[model samples]
Target: MAEIKILGAGPVKRGVTQIAAQFEQGTGHRVNVEFTGAPTVRERVLAGEAVDVAVVPQSAMEEFVAQGRVSADTRVTLGRSRMGLALRKGAAAPDLTTVAAFKQAVAAADAVVVNVASSGNYVVKLLEKQGFSADKAVKQPDTVKVMDHVASSAQNLLGAGQLPEIRELVDKGVAIALAGPLPDELQSITAYDAAVTTASANAAAAAEFAAYLELPAARAAMAATGID
Candidate 1:
């Protein structure tokens, strides 16, 4: 059996982890997935890490294609994850029906916890464009930390991140989703893509795994976690 090592962005973790377990069970291939910030995945791959598969944001895939870091023909669209907001579990959920309402809620918070990952970065950019001070956010390196910041604080802090990440914390009773996704027009949806890396030790197995991600069953797994 081939051993497949995959490097993926943190926002896609839950869905990918679910799918990977299923794939391994069905095919008898050992699938090991490492989830980190999108930026870190890009850095490791560009630095010549030999992971069999790389699942990253579509924007990064474009760069990888240009650099020949991954096999062009094996790339497939994974799914898109929407940016969202969360707050402490016991706090009243905010009305996020409009961009203005969303902004006001964030502004009135004691502090905002956001990661430096894709969704977090998008939130910071949106805040900047809306004339909100980005400094008001407590920037962490990943979604786990963003949730941790909120869980440990008694202050009214908002956590802005990928919908799936926020959902995980909400399910754990540490936080509640302020919105499934931000207001449509103001939302940032990150499309993720996957492929067999050029540095893969088992290219054929990696290609098989990448293609498996496009299956209806796989999409369902992703959709269950707010990616679609």
Candidate 2:
């Protein structure tokens, strides 16, 4: 069994985990998953972390490929994400029907949990696009801490060792909204790419696993988690 590494965001994390579990159960290959913030994952990859495949927001993928850390040809679109609001388990969900409504809701919040580095960038840009450029927002160094703030009652789980789960925040009691979907006009389509690491011990098997991520079984797994 070849070791596979994944770097992804929250929504896709569940899909990846499900796919990995299924793959291992069916093919006898053990898959190890690590979930963390996207920026941390990107930094680690840039810093020379050994990764078999990386699942990141599309916004970050191009930059990574440009830096030679990811293979341009192996990239694949994982799914889409929209900044939706999350309230603690029993908290009332915010109304985000319009940009103005969204702003009002955000302005009325006690504390906002946002990731300034990765996921937060998109939210900030969305806010700016809506003409809300105030710099005083609940800023966190990374998504993990932001998620913690979003829902401390619920444990945060990291996917692909870099991505976070939205449910984690909803479970805790954080309201989430986005400026837009993750990638500018794409409704937050975070594409995940898999490539055999340069130092992989089983490059062939790793490639196969990477290819498997695009198969129906993998797509089904992704769909199960609200990603398509």
Which candidate has the highest lDDT of all?
1
lDDT of 1 by residue, 133-200 (tens): 76887898888888878877899888888888778777777645555468998988789999899999
lDDT of 2: 0.59
lDDT of 2 by residue, 1-228 (tens): 666776554557677888888888878877878777767777877775777777777767777777877666666776664444443444555555665666676666654556665556656666566565555346777655665565553422111112225654444455432222222231333445444445345556666677788898788777666665
Task: Quote each prediction's TM-score.
Answer: 0.95, 0.76
For residue 14, model 1's alpha carbon misses the true position, in angstroms, by: 1.3
lDDT score of residue 119 within candidate 1: 75
Error of 2 at 25 (Å): 1.7
Candidate 2 off by > 4 Å? 128-136, 142-144, 151-164, 168-189
Error of 2 at 11 (Å): 2.9
